[model samples]
Target: MRIITGIYKGRHFDIPRTFKARPTTDFAKENIFNVLNGYIDLEDAIALDLFSGTGSISLELVSRGCQSVISVEADRDHHAFIKQCLKKLGTDRCIALRGDVFRFIKSCHQQFDFIFADPPYALPELPTLPKLILERGLLKPNGIFVFEHGKNNSFEDVPGFIEHRAYGSVNFSIFSNREPEGEDE
Candidate 1:
C-alpha cells in the first residue's frame, strides 16, 4: 500500500502474502481524501479507524497531520504489521489496537473529529456498522464518518447520510452527526 499524499506521500508498504486484509487502492484512497479535504480539516483532528486493515488509513491520517489516531483491527497479524509501520515512520500519533471493532465501538467513551471504517465486504455485519457507530455517539458534532464497502451495499437511505461515492468496486458512504440545514427540530 502507498500513501498518496501528505508528509508520507509516495511511501509504500509491502503487505505479506499471508495477509487477508484488503488495503484500499491508491486510486480510491486518493479520491476519498480529496472528498474529505473539502469537508474537514485533518490538521490536529482526532481520528478513529475501525477495521483498520494494514493501517493504511491510519497512517494516511497521521501523515496529513491529525493530532491523534486510534486504529482498531481484529486480526492479530494485521495489528502487529500496523504497529511496525507506525514505528518505521517514527510517529507516535497513531495507536494500533488489536481487538474486535464492534466491542471497541461499544466501549469507547471518547468522541472523534473523523472516523473511517473499511471492514471486509463479505462480513455479515457490514450493513449495520453505520447505524451502530452513529447511534453510539462516537462522532463529535459535525464530525464525518466514512464507511467503505462493496458496490452491492447502499447507504443513501440511512439517517445522517450526507453522500455516497463509488470508486470502481469500492463504495464509500459518508455521514455526519449534525442534521441537514433547513430542517425544523
Candidate 2:
C-alpha cells in the first residue's frame, strides 16, 4: 500500500502474503480522504486508528499532518511491521500498540479529534462498533468518526449519522457528535 498524499506521499509499503488483514484499497482510501477534507482539518488533530491492519490509515493520518496518531493492531506480526514502518519513516508522530480493538475502546478515556476503524467486515461485532465508540465519549464535541464496513451494513438511522459514502465494494459511514447545521435549538 502507498500513501496518497501529504509529507509521505508516494511512499509504498509491501504487505506480506501470509497476512489476513484487508488493508483499505487505494481507491477507497483516496476517496474517503477527499470526503474528509471537505469536513474536517487533519492538521494538528489527534487521531485514532482501530483495527489498524498494516498501519496504513495511521501512517496516512501522520502524513497528512495530524499532531499525533495512535494505531492499535492485534496481530503481533502486524504490530511489529507497523513499528518498523514508523522507524523507517523517521517519524515519532504515531504510536503503535498491540491489543484487541474492543478492549482498547472500553478502556480508553481520552478523546480524539478524528477516529477511524476498519474492522474485518465479517466480524460479528461490526454492527455494535459505532455505538460502542460513540457512547464511550471517544470523540471530542466536534470530532469525526469514520467506520469502514461492508455493503451489508447501514448506519444512516444511527444518532450522529452525518453521511455515507461508497467506493466499489468499500463503504464508510461518517458520524459526529455535533448537530448538523440548522438543527441547533
Among all candidates shown, the one with the greatest lDDT: 2
Candidate 2 C-alpha lDDT tens digits along 54-107: 999999999999999999999999999999899989999999999999999999
Model 1, position 112: C-alpha lDDT score = 100
Whole-model lDDT values for every prediction: 0.94, 0.95
Please give, for residues 27-56, the per-residue lDDT of candidate 1 as tens digits: 999999999998899999999999998999
TM-scores of all predicted structures? 0.96, 0.96
The segments of candidate 2 whose C-alpha lies over 4 angstroms from its true place after superposition are 179-185
Model 2 poorest 10 in a row by lDDT = 176-185
Each candidate's root-mean-square deviation in Å? 1.4, 1.3
